[model samples]
Target: MRAPCERSERHRSVARRRWISRASWACLMAACLGGAAPPFVSSVSFAQQPGARQAPPPAVVVEKIEVQQVSNPAQFTGRVEAIEAVDIRARVTGFLHSVDFKDGQAVKAGDTLFEIEPDQLNALVASARAQVARADATRISAERSLARNRDLLARRTVSQATVDEVQAAFDVASADVQVAQAALDTAELNLSYAHITAPISGSIGRATFTTGNLVGPDSGSLARIVSLDTVRVAFAVTEGLLVTIRQQQASGGGLDPNTLKLSLRLANGTDYGTPGRIEFIENEIDPQTGTVAARAVFPNPRHILLPGQFVTLYVQEKDAPSLPVVPQTAVLQDREGRFVYLLGKDNIVSQQRIHTGARVGNGWAVTKGLDGGEQVVVEGIQRLAQGMTVQPSQGQPVGGGT
Candidate 1:
């Protein structure tokens, strides 16, 4: 009874409506089972559930602060100096004949360092000897004359005035002989100067004058010698620090120069294995720099330290008092001040402000705001909040057991 074209159109519309209904049912089932609520159900479900709590404070490594005896060393820039340094120079004018020692060689006292031409000096010595011989002959003749005159005067053969004149001539001859002897001694001394010798035992620098060069007393220096067995390190400290040291000494908290320990760090950041002692302190403080100069002596048996080398001098007071110290990593700074997270009785982290002093090895010396026997958070400090509860575990204190 219906037309065939109209029936075909109705069948296609019914099939499309059924397919859409099945797709909507599958989506709803996937959302509910996968724990993903549909947009319309999300707000309703959240309202029905209880409120969520914050995550537990992160687990942190904590350690109890302990007091220990530590030397709070102070570091200052310094320079190495030789115990004895000398500039080798020629004492006479002559042509340089030879250099006895090689450049940068170790030398002992009385070692020949240079040789100057001695031909002229030898001629002078011969001339002086001839003069001495002439003066000696004159003295002999004058003495004989005086003796004969004295005998004649006793025998009444000569007058008193003639004997007196002969005695005066003998005295003049004797004086001439003495003067010639002195001249000969001076010539010999000049000859000795031609062969220059080392004045002290030390390492020698390069020679400034070579063979064939005219060397003289006015020549600045032929070479340099520096004693390296023991070296001195000179450094300057602030006046304020000096005052504090004196005050500590008065209170028995500081050490004397003999008892203090010193160490050096080379420019390349390597430690000098040998230890040194503070041997000298300047008598007056430098007014312009507001500093006091101090010096320490170190034994350099192998000649490891060289003069004029820059280094760092570390001064440590022996027998220093014990103080509360914490790992440097535990300390933190902010707008307020430097502080550390302390774990109290209930495992609550509290930010405790601290006044820090010099570094004691890898730890910080606490000057104030902290007593011994308090847990300090070292690992989880970054995540910590004031008054936050945390689970703390014991860990080794920093600086390897300190």
Candidate 2:
């Protein structure tokens, strides 16, 4: 190699000649194109470089906005309740002789739940019977005495006052007999109560009092039974929602609450397949809560729903407004709020700000921003930027409704 400075000078001279040639070529190209540089010359300077490759636009999957019929369901936390709930309490005082049913047992109306030992109750019944028999014996004797006394008076052998006195004695005995029979009837009724039976078909809870435990009417409750074949769900609605249920429509006083459709999501998040109908709405809102009570009846043949179970209740109105819907994948969110990339004319994508409402099936109900006919990018959004051009293809989102 020659001296270092001379070698560097020769290299600089060659680079300057190349630079001048490139500048002259760029000027000639600019002149040929109009009097200004090409559009990409400033922002994408490499486009003017010789042999540079152009990139293809990114591909994106898009879904068209669809008009979806929705029910606009109102959601609230609810509780599972039996239409008929009864606490099992012994009507007559006695020792619990036998627990007739197992804990958590399914029972029908008139099913024997427990048997209270009827030692004292039976004694009372026997005593009542004895008193009634004695009253009958006394009444018979008094009537015979009165008849003989009246016969003596008819023969003029006795005074009328004596016969009248005997008659009064007979009346007193008859009254005693009637009182005794009434007591016996009450005793029999009490005996029947000793055999505690379910008043309604339902699932029975655990037995509170076991064998040898003295239970009576005053005893809190021996157990509880709740009806299962047809259950009810109780939920509270806000003042606004209460109005919606009672007066959703202007005419006809409002939508009939009986016509409102109801459904439930259990605590475990599984949906109860059976639908329910609104059965009751309170006459007034609760003064303390400002919420009104409402109930829906559901057919629970399987007894899967239990009383006091917390659930998520959904009440749907039939005359819901049609809404613009889009697949969830098309939505993008940042600090500025939610937006979707709209596939506009000539494959250009622009950001569309949207006000989203409730989710409808697998998609979102678009409350605002988009009409029902526009297309939006649902996939390949990672590489997207504002005003970008993309290769758009249709995305698949199937059937709707829940």
Candidate 3:
């Protein structure tokens, strides 16, 4: 056996020779198999080199520009109201005698609602009539005395002062009759007021004062009545839009009070079929809210629109102007700002920042950044980098129904 150092050198030399022989065999096999040997050799090579990484492409959908009709109707929140609403209050102070109408019942103008006890008024009227009868008897006696005095004055049997006294007595009796007649009229008026009557045709609300309850002229409202044959919807127009409204009115290009068309949607999302016209707009804008009050009248024949009901108002006008719009999916947000991917002629995606306005259906009105004819990537933006080349397909959006 050799020394220890000599033994180590002999083992290294044998290992090198073995590696050389294995490499030569591999080279010969690769030459024979040519292209077929690469996969197998690559597998062997991959085993030696570890930690290789693979990246995936982003998946998305897209859309193109198409011409369409766009409407920019003024939008506002409003409330349904009766054309006229009045609170029923007692005209004279007295105990309520009887209630004539049921709660929530439809009423007509001059319909009796509540009957107050008119016993005192009736007594007063009867007393006034008696006084009138007494005055009539006294006047007859004075008239007979006056005629005798006039005859004696004509015959020079009495002085002028005596005739004047008799005439004055007759005049006093006639004046008393007029006074009593006025008193009777007052009593009659009071009795009529005792019967609470509706001032306007409407539907009566729950009674605040019932039978035997004391009510007075100065008392707060006893009940409420709202006329629903025609209803008004009150809404506010923002100060920003006020200028546009005025401009439209001044141009005489859009609907005026007579020609304007209006519609309403109920709280439950049902549309009021009868279209309305703008009745009036307030002269001044509200200083507190910076909005102008506008009223539109709708025919409520069936009394469907009730007072105090919340409603959404849609004031329809002629077509506005056309605006550029893109699918909502195309819009993307990041820390920088809102953006979308634009596909170039080479099927590459480029980042584009956009300024948007009102949303029309499922698309946004692009005010800035994108123009007509620019293809925006509605889908597949996530799969792309700023400069990465991508395969683009005209992605059809799922649903965009009106």
Q: How would you order the candidates by TM-score, starting with the best?
A: 1, 2, 3
Tell me the lDDT of model 1 at 35: 74
Give lDDT per model, in order: 0.89, 0.87, 0.81
Candidate 1 structure lDDT: 0.89
Summed backbone clashes in each candidate are 0, 0, 8
Worst 10 residues of 3 by lDDT: 393-402
Please state the error at residue 336 of candidate 1 in Å. Answer: 13
lDDT of 3 at 140: 93
Two-way lDDT contest, 1 vs 3, winner: 1
How far in Å is the alpha carbon of 151 misplaced in model 3? 2.4
lDDT-better candidate, 2 vs 3: 2
| Tens digits of lDDT, candidate 1, 117-162 | 9999999999999989999999999999999999999999999999
User: What RMSD does model 2 have?
Assistant: 8.9
* Per-residue alpha-carbon lDDT of candidate 2 for residues 1-402, written as tens digits (9 for 90 to 100): 569989999999999999999999999987878845665466466655544665788999988788877666789899988789899888888899999899988999999889988878899999999999999999999999998998899899999999889999999999999999999999988988888888988889999988998888898988999888998889998998667745756555676666677889998889999998888878888989999998888999998998888999988875677888888888889999999999988999999899998788878888889888888888998799999999988887534783
Alpha-carbon TM-score of each model against the true structure: 0.75, 0.71, 0.68
